[model samples]
Target: MAESNKNGATARLRNYFLAGVLITAPISITFWLTWRVITFIDDRITPIIPPQWNPESYLPFGVPGLGLIVALVALTLIGFLAAGYLGRVTMRIGERIVARVPVIRSVYSWTKQVFETVLSQSSAAFREVVLIEYPRPGCWAVGFITGTTVGEVQRLTAATVYNVFVPATPNPTTGFLLFVPKEDVHHLDLTVEEGIKLVISGGIVVPDQANFEGAEVDAAAKAQVAAQSDRAENVEGNGRKRRRRKQTQEPRSPGFITRLRNYFFAGILVTAPIAITVWLAWEFVAFVDGTVTPYIPAPWNPETYLPFSIPGLGVVIVVLGLIMIGFLTAGFVGRSLVSASERLLARMPVIRSLYSAVKQIFETVLKEQSRAFREVILFEYPRKNCWALGFITGPAEGGIQELTPDDTVNVFLPTTPNPTSGFLLFLPRRETQILSMTVEEGIKMVVSGGIVTPPDREVGDAAEPEESTPAPLAKSG
Candidate 1:
């Protein structure tokens, strides 16, 4: 009897502990998320807020929630204004302008839908929570019934469909809007609020649902990694037992170690590019300051007047000096002087070759009309049917065109990971394929080894031909 009493006490203690945890966790998470949101808004909105309008400007110490409060008021005010006649007309005009832009139109429409679904409290918006397969078969997700399909969509898909919005976990703002068939949808017993809560909690904190029995739906859904075994499971038809090949247990949340690793990688992703860019910029400025600062005229230098040294003074001086040189070089006297200098340099053997090469490189690069490495083309290389990316430097004139054919064209086939060095091929014009990708995009693909790709464009809808006025590489002596 004493042993039984002790066991009962132990069980009660465990229940009490669990109940305390159940109460504490949600409250703690809610407060943490709230703080995070407030700070994030403050960081962004604080800078843009005028000193006169911002209350923190008057205070000695910075206030945190000022920006958040401002943001709330601004959004509410905007909403109120949007409902007015003038604001509505302005919005419609703005939308019309946005709709004219092909890419922006798609993005705007999608963004508008997300806002409407999440914020709208109308009868047609998120009427009820539902269950549907998403991403792939057997992978079920909790969704909200945004609306029923209409017009083109209903006509195109020969079935009764509902516009189901499956909100991503941890963030209900952005997610997939699936046009799910009505037959596939399982009307969950949970409310819309419960569904949203389920998503925000990352499938944790599941509400007790009486739609489906335990151990049966898990086997049928063929559950995946996500902790979706319980909440995302669909109801069985007519309470029939499903014949199952596999009976897997509910997937658990990621362990502490996994979460730690993910956080570490995420931190690296955010910091790496910023840290590298800052370091590189600093190094470049320091190099210029060390090499060129001493030579700069005292009057021209800003550091001479300032009490504290400026970081990018050398860079500013260099840019101004280049602009001045360019202006001087455009004059008739400058041209005569340059011609005389070139004639003198042409008398040398090695010096002439180097100077000629450098000058030609600069001229070609600087000239807007010179389409050197401007056009992206494709041609067979090494073997037939095997293609390669090449830039059209110019026409295959001189001996190469004479020896081959009148239709021959010069192509520079760039290598992967390094576009500095490449093979030069002279092929027939008919054999080459002109691609829609620009030279910049081609270089990017080459540098990244095909990791980054340019979006596909229709062949017939390609831009104008690569050649710009007076054919390329036909330079006058």
Candidate 2:
């Protein structure tokens, strides 16, 4: 009895341990990630910031986190300006000036275009998530649809166009972008978050509830069989010849060893979900810590809070704080910061070049939050038959079209697996079919390389048709 009690206690303790591990890992990992990103930004600022003006000089604390604060304030002020009319005028003036400068103008406008596409609310880019086939046959991935094909190519050759982004497995941020025709790309039923989880797990995670239900049904059926056998045995012992005859007619009862094996296996099937969940969660925590924690300074040791840190708390707090400041700058505190940054950057010649380059990229990509990567679509490119993912930006407007004497639309085509690079093609509108899919779906398909096929009407095709009710002809008469 004592041995049995001890074993029970050990089992309970193990369960408790597993539960704790499952809960705390995600929180600690998030904090570690936030800290690492902050530190990286500080490292970049450290080399450029003079020792006297540096926030570190004034603080006794190890590596000040105020640079992140500065970035937040700056962003907020920029948001405020961008939201208002005066800000637009200033931005236009800056654009006009940049356009006049030869080398700087080319780099500035290109960088600006990318940012505008991504940040502007009108850009409508990366709005929808999708699935696509990727890497090899039978493999699928999640992606987003950015936009459509554009430019003189459209006048020359009318085609239905799309831009698909196929995200990398385990890392959705990096992936391929294929511009294909609208007809070839199919939409998936899975949500972006679910798709990401599937990719990261490499298809190991199954979400079908039917499997569990079926297992339950099988177990219940086996239980019913055992119950029937018990009743038959009882009847035989209770009565005489008739009962003995009835028992003989029934099938043979299962052996004790076989019954025991079935029961044990059933128990395992029931607990397998909980066991696997605990194991995966533990592994996830370990992986995040291994990847992000080492980059953090020793002083912020996350292990101290082990088993509980508030999941994604770091990301939540930091992002919220930044956004809040942005909201405030849209009011007042934000404006002052932007003016200061602009003035400071404008004063130095060499610093101006570097600052402008980085600032331009940030403004276009992160500042205005343009609609560059709004819709993901499939666009046929290079030839009549092939297709790839392309983002639909605005219609092309340039002197090149005036020179061509033919109507043309412009489109930017991004490279796949690494969206940062790709071809820029001009194609006609008639050839392109605007997809029913949202921008997010197109990206997943592109990034996944066509692996993640989104569910369609066919998934429900197995269900039997229901009988229709007879028409009320008698009432009409």
**TM-score winner among the candidates?**
1
In Å, residue 191's CA in model 1 sits off its true spot by 49
Scored against the true structure, residue 182 in model 2 reaches a CA lDDT of: 40
lDDT of each: 0.61, 0.52
lDDT of 1 by residue, 1-477 (tens): 999999999999999999999999989989999999999989978999988988778888999798877765565555456556886697778767867976445434433433333343333446567676664556667876655544323333436656555566797755544456554556666767887889999978688856322212343443321224232333222122242222224436778765555444433333333344456567899999888899988897777898998888788878988998879889998888889999999999999999999999788866999877778876655344223468888788888888997598878876544567667889898887776677765665444333233445653323321110110110000
Tell me the TM-score of each prediction against the true structure: 0.43, 0.39
List residue ranges in candidate 1 displaced over 4 A.
Answer: 1-249, 283-287, 304-308, 459-477
Q: Candidate 2, overall lDDT?
A: 0.52
Candidate 1 weakest lDDT stretch, 10 residues: 468-477
